[model samples]
Target: MTNERRVLVHPDADALVAAVSARFLTKLTDLLDEHHEANVVLTGGTLGEAVQKAVATSPMRSAIDWTRVHFWWGDERFVPKDDPDRNEVQAREALLQHLPTAEDHIHPFPASDEIEDIDAAAEAYAQELRDHADPALRLPVPRFDITFLGVGPDGHIASLFPEHGVTRDGQDLVVSDEDSPKPPPRRLSLTLPVINSSQRIWMVLAGTEKASALGLALAGASPEEVPVAGAEGRLRTVFFIDGDAASHVPADLIASQY
Candidate 1:
């Protein structure tokens, strides 16, 4: 991982989305150039959806082969697949519906109805990763080329909320979080260990309310207190902040060399 935190500040949310979209496309193109496929972990939120929309509408959208790109979500609401609140549903409407990607490439968490047992559903997703990865791999998890994440006002990422047991649990790549501050109460989230396994991770923030949380995360707060602070990718980790969300970060802090 790099020593410096890569923070990109934009004039507004629209500009932020454009910058993030370009970065996302560059990362995807790099992954495809090095490997035959690209695996991306998506998130659910306004900023996240904006990035997806950017990708869908970008002029370079056609440069990559959508068919070979694999999509996964960082977390999901434990709702029926067709529920309007489901992240998958929102993502499809925002971007996937526009992409030429194959159905098999889109892997969403199991719907509550699909698997009666939430724990079993999480385990099933873990097994799916194992099946796709080589046995000799130490991590035993798929190396995501890019993981797009959104931070909650409480400084949570994915479904890993502050002081939640799932935030510290190290075994499962996917786990059911039962005490999320935000509801539906129950959710499936990628553990911090799994999130750190990605080659690149990007945390996107847009609203003014997120400014305080962004400052705390940048200050290196503990994940137990602010879960977003724990994100660390092997190759790179970036924070894409709009002016509104970066207002609380001190000018000197941002000017410091790492």
Candidate 2:
């Protein structure tokens, strides 16, 4: 069964980031109060980076025990660790550096130096997930309290593009490609099954470029034709979008805030 989705429209980009950051802190604090630890899968993109920066600067930044929160990336550019385009690099500079966390808690994708190739990196990451996942959960990945994601203009989620074979390749936890439609062609991403296994999924969308894609996904488009349409959390899925991105959504599909 699929989880229900909720769309929230903010006034602008900054507002969207602030709202998400605050909500993320609240969610983490609550989860820690209940379980004493939490795992979050992060995304890397314009909005993703922005949200991290917001979290670093938020007044509530010191509220949670960052060391107990395990961080994982949903996808990463296949480049050296220090490359500007690398998701792990950007995330560290934007947010992780500011938090009080143990080095072992940061689970970045294998960099070019650590693997023979992108495909090898994917397999290594899959192995890491399997090794760390709680045996009791009976799931391939860890218990992701919240997995944050960003949608591309073409309706792609993570590295899964429209009609891509990887989107349907359930056997693999992660997939790699050296010829992506987007730049920095080579990349690695978690498969749909791994992403959907999360307890909650938060999709952050911004700008007019994402408007049509959001419209199509929310309009019951097929997951193969619009990969973002298949991204759903097991317990709940929430879309935090700016006004520009929410513009194309049908009136009946959006909440009153719009």
Candidate 3:
């Protein structure tokens, strides 16, 4: 069974950050208590980095067993590993640097500079996931415990842009995107099939410029029109939005309760 999409609106960016941080800690604690290991797929963007900062600043940060948490990227900028624009670099500055996780547990996509071939690098990442699968389990693929994603003002998520082939296919995972609307133009994104396999998924939006896209997604736009509409999770799917971002969503409906 799949969970219905739900939204949580906050008064401002600060409040949104707090809500995301609190929920993140709660989810991490609950997952840790219920299972010995947890897999987290993280997104990259201003809001995504803010959530990381909030986690780092939260008092309950220490409660998580970082060693048992496997971190993965939802999508990354096709740049050099050390580039300031790289998602991994920003993520490290915000939270990963403060966490006690072993360096090996942090899984970042290959750098465009080092790999030379973007498609090959993406294929390697897919292979890594396959290699990590539990031998005893006959599941089609390894599933993540949680996946944190952020939507673009254009409504794309995890590099799955509107009308893109990757957004329409039901592949387990994708190794390359040929026509990304976003800059850098190329990326590897988890397909809808893989994204929906997660136990939980959270979509966070913060800027006022994102309001229109948020409204469309909550109103059930087609994935080809707004890729964010494709977001789904087997257990839960949540939308975390600040006031500026939620302003366009109908007041009588979703955001009012929050």
Top lDDT model:
2
TM-score of 2: 0.95
How do all models score by TM-score? 0.93, 0.95, 0.91
lDDT of 3 at 27: 85
- Each prediction's total of clashing residue pairs, residues at least 3 apart in sequence or on different chains, is 0, 0, 0
Q: Which has the better lDDT: candidate 1, or candidate 3?
A: 1
lDDT of 2: 0.88
If candidate 2 were superposed on the true structure by all CA atoms, what would the RMSD be? 1.8
lDDT against the true structure, per candidate, is 0.84, 0.88, 0.81
In terms of lDDT, the poorest run of 10 residues in model 3 is: 134-143
* Stretches > 4 Å off in candidate 3: 134-140, 251-258
TM-score of 3: 0.91
- Per-residue CA lDDT of candidate 2, range 83-156, in tens? 99998988999999999889889999999877868888999999989977866554677899999999988899
**Preferred candidate (lDDT higher): 2 or 3:** 2
**Tens-digit lDDT track of model 1 for 1-258:** 464457777889998899889878877888888988888999998988888889899998988888889999898888888988789998999999999999988889988889878899898888877766634335677768788999989898999888886354457778897666888887898789888888788899988889988888888898889888899877778888888888878775553221
